[model samples]
Target: MEAMLEHHDGIALFTICRPEKRNAINFAVMGALEEAMEQAAADPQVKVFAITGAGSEAFCSGGDLSEFGHLRGTEARQMLMRMGELLYRLLTFPKPTAALVNGTAMGGGCELATACDFRFAKEGSRIGFVQGRLGITTGWGGASMLFAKLPYGRALDVLLRAEPMTAEAMEACGWVDAILPAEHWHEQWRERLAPYAERSLSVLQAYKAAAGEKWRTAWFREQFFAEIARCAELWGSAEHEQALRPFLCKK
Candidate 1:
């Protein structure tokens, strides 16, 4: 499968397997991810869940905007909702979600990691909210989560400047929980999950759900939709279209 979904010892793992695309997420990838999350939720044996990219180049580049060029009206709306729903699913998930950010994380990649309770980054990886470069805010609730996690100035610097920061820089800003050597990132992550695996799955789920209470309310979803609607309007504007032009020209 282009998207990898597998379970191991009460720890369901999701991997974005399309390294050739820099682990960029397509609609298919989104669907697979949603399915995986649901599976993890349903499995009594699962406690802590983790997601990451297959390779070192990228965690995810974001939506396939080539597809965006073709979408209009309802299709565009559906895309927005799908992206938000998937982010919501991850954010409100009952289990403690972890993101093994093994490489460069930008745009939607940042959103994915932001949804998790812990982001375990690989050393040398970088992270950014690149949506500003395309004249949009974060497509998911990343901005809100970022503000919750970062000092105000740091959050403002990332959201407003749209600058990419090295994994170390991101850690300095409080974006990542831990950064490990790329050569042994997987091993270290497995070790981290070991303690989680030993914990009672039910207790883990209960505590995780409690932690997500503020972040995953109906009111929050409403706010998120309003924010993304603004983004859609921006995406349809000349300035944003102009910004996205270069990505279209990439061969």
Candidate 2:
């Protein structure tokens, strides 16, 4: 499946469905998510949106690294811009949002979770930013959001190191808002959101919109444009290609 969007009560859940590849994302999945978010925004019926992967294995592993070899420099930049813009939209979305961290959330997967307002993880989930080992920084603005969400030193430790971090360790850094055993993730998540769901949808949405609007300012756009340029240059490099060799066959 490209992606799945389902609604229960006022919450819309989006799932990335390619578990065989650990839910790696592609252009189609991105577009499906964008469309789902747009629909949620337009409908008065939906008040909360949550994103997660389909399997118990991963939230989102990252971009499909295996798919990177075909596009060079400029084409690659266009792709980055598209995905970055989508994440920006999600980050600034006008309703309550959450990420169900079902398992390992790496690279773009981590970025997707970070874009949401709340990240609720399974106790067993191991979250990390893997871009550094790939010879790049976070490509979809996950780093910027991570910095905003985490305390100064903790943010540095996680984003800079780009290594595996257990749910408890991440919670210590204020990365995971709430954690429960893997089997209890769904029940805990729905319960955590129950209070917000009780409020009038309009009121809840207005509060959500106001908070996001405060940061959805000029500077966010500026950062995005700058990162686009950086990613474009990085995509053209021999070093990045070399580091990505195992994941990408250089077709």
Tell me the lDDT of model 1 at 239. 76
Misplaced by over 4 Å in model 2 are none
- Write the residue-wise lDDT of candidate 2 on 14-84 in tens digits: 99998987898998898899999999888787888899998898889989876755578778888888888
Where does candidate 2 clash, by residue pair? none
Best by lDDT: 2
TM-score of 2: 0.95
lDDT per residue as tens, model 1, 120-170: 888888888989988778766677677766898988898988978888888
Which window of 10 residues has the lowest lDDT sum in candidate 2? Answer: 242-251
TM-score against native, each model: 0.95, 0.95
After best superposition, candidate 2 residue 222: deviation in angstroms?
0.6
The runs of at least 3 residues in candidate 1 whose Cα sits more than 4 Å from the true structure, single-residue gaps closed, are none
